[model samples]
Target: MTSRSEILREKMEELIAVGALAPGQHLDETELAARFGVSRTPIRETLIQLASMGLVVMRPRRGALVAELGPHQLVEMFEVMSELEATCSRLAARRMTPADHVRLLAAHLACREARDASDPDAYYYKNEAFHEAIYAGSHNQFLLEQTRNLYRRLRPYRRLQLRVRDRVGASYEEHDGLVQAILAGDGDRAEQLTRSHVMIQGQRFADLMASLPQLAAGELLAPGAAGRTRREGAPAP
Candidate 1:
């Protein structure tokens, strides 16, 4: 049987994924526990773990709420993702095995095939796979973990930008450059290319926010915007 904490965590993750709990929305313990058919203890423990992961914030005397990313915080995350990917690419040039190279190449080909087929979702998944293969090839657990966390944090933003016309094709071209750099063992070039590749998403996000005034207003007014000070009632993470 699943442990209480695990079950509660799954339920909470589901809630977050489905938009039942929007960014900056407070998490009601009693309501969540009741909804999940669990006790408050598991809910409390899970909330703490989530908060530590930057998924929620726990506030003093108040409660837990989803972590909100203001425009600045989103930019910071993009900056961090760029650095992480660059470092991973640089290290991967030194550490990648022949098998790793093959896998990365295959992932890139998969993305190319998907892009040629005009399957945006498939192309997106394959593109992620290509980077993930590179990340795993870097062979550093700490870096791997950091990359994974940042990817999750960037998911919503990524999805928002995915379907813009020609975006997938442009992304594939960027990946082509990244793969070429790594294949040639040009570590500095690889680092530069990967970092720029990741930052493109930041640019896309800024454009998106500018185009959609409503979303900007929502983000600006939302609690805990831009990774600011923790709210006392914010969920644990």
Candidate 2:
């Protein structure tokens, strides 16, 4: 990434981290450039990239804004996300090299260590590592890129929803299943496992919307997720 692009990306993530760029808020290019001591050109380019990732919306003439995340949109996104991950897992089973297998197993072990230590933050990174390993193992550039983009787009929501009761434990178990499926080269099972992995969040988000109807309009899972059970009926891989 260019320095300006890197700066803009970091600042944008910071805005999300803070409450400055809450969901649905328009991104002011002029104001952001001035605040970050950068030029508008890089900001514009970065905004376009963010728009492609489904994190921002670029209107024809109205400039860019954070994407509005209603429950319906969340459901749609999660559905797509689950399909993409399932594809990744299916591909990984056939394409993964020995090195890829080792790296994925290491990620699973890291998650086990993180869970044993009760470190949620570390577990999050380890969880990411596990998914990324599978993405790389898939050996499809397009699928890998799309999977990564959606993962980043959903990061904030995952962090929020996973804070529900024993969600971290459940997430770790899912990771274990993924590792097992990959090591065994079970393409069908791998795809099934990953599809369920992502749809569980959608189910939680739906339940959350049911409990807090306010979230049905703006953001999908904020102000606490109601945390439903994992989606029980994912499609067969």
Candidate 3:
């Protein structure tokens, strides 16, 4: 069962994704508590959770606000996420046990089902499971935790990527290749395939930009826009 904090976080994320809460909008604890029929305690906790996910920014005196990453910042995040995922895949190829293989295969199968059903939301959840399997198969606790952290931070943008034309189908094919490489215990191939699968570059990045105009009536920042800077204290890795 989902905790109160988790439910509140999900609702807040939906609001942001649907543009009901624009970027940099202040999150009033009292209002959210009333909206969710909970006390301010859970709302406070939920803001902290969202802050850790990079979806909310908590300033020293400004309280909590929705995070708004500029295009360059978003790309920087994707680059780091790509490397983390590639590392996980490489280690997974070397360390995955029989049970790990079974779990990963199951997740892939579920992703296939979601794709075939043409449900982007369902596919998005399954895609998360598929990556989680890879992270677990790495068998490195620190790496798994770190990758999961970055993965959570990138979740919203990753979901948006699926809205790109034919992206879900292409992503499924990439997963097939990754699974085959990992099953063969080919760490090099697994690293390469996973990197390509996760990295938003060239045509894929362009396609993502093209799809964003429909997201919020030009509210989303375009690449090369002025005043775009990386998040303070965010690691460049």
User: Per-residue alpha-carbon lDDT of model 3 for 1-237, expressed as tens digits?
Assistant: 756566567677655644455566788989888877899998889889888778799988878987877778878988998999999999999999999999999999999999999977567778888998899899998988899778766655776788787999999999999999999999999999998999988998888777655544424323332122222212222
lDDT of 2 by residue, 1-237 (tens): 336576567557534422246667788999878866778988888888778767789998898888666777777888898999999999999899999998888878888898888766456656777788888899998888888777777665655555455777888898888888888999999999989888855557655555333322334333322222111211101
The deviation in Å at residue 2 for candidate 1 is: 8.8
| Model 2 lDDT, full chain set | 0.71
Listed per model in order, the count of residue pairs whose N, CA or C atoms clash below 3 Å is 16, 0, 0
When 2 and 3 are scored with TM-score, the better candidate is 3
Query: Which candidate order results from sorting by TM-score in descending order?
Result: 3, 2, 1
RMSD of each: 7.7, 7.4, 7.7
What TM-score does candidate 2 get on C-alpha atoms? 0.77
Q: How many clashing pairs does model 3 include?
A: 0
Once fitted onto the true fold, the runs of candidate 2 whose alpha carbons sit more than 4 angstroms away are 1-3, 10-20, 59-63, 201-203, 207-237
Candidate 1 deviant stretches above 4 angstroms: 1-11, 14-20, 34-37, 113-124, 200-203, 210-237
Worst 10 residues of 2 by lDDT: 228-237
Best by lDDT: 3
Lowest lDDT 10-mer window, candidate 3?
Answer: 228-237
How do these models rank on lDDT, best leading?
3, 1, 2
| Among all candidates shown, the one with the greatest TM-score | 3
Instruction: List the candidate 3 regions with Cα displacement exceeding 4 Å.
Output: 1-22, 60-62, 213-237
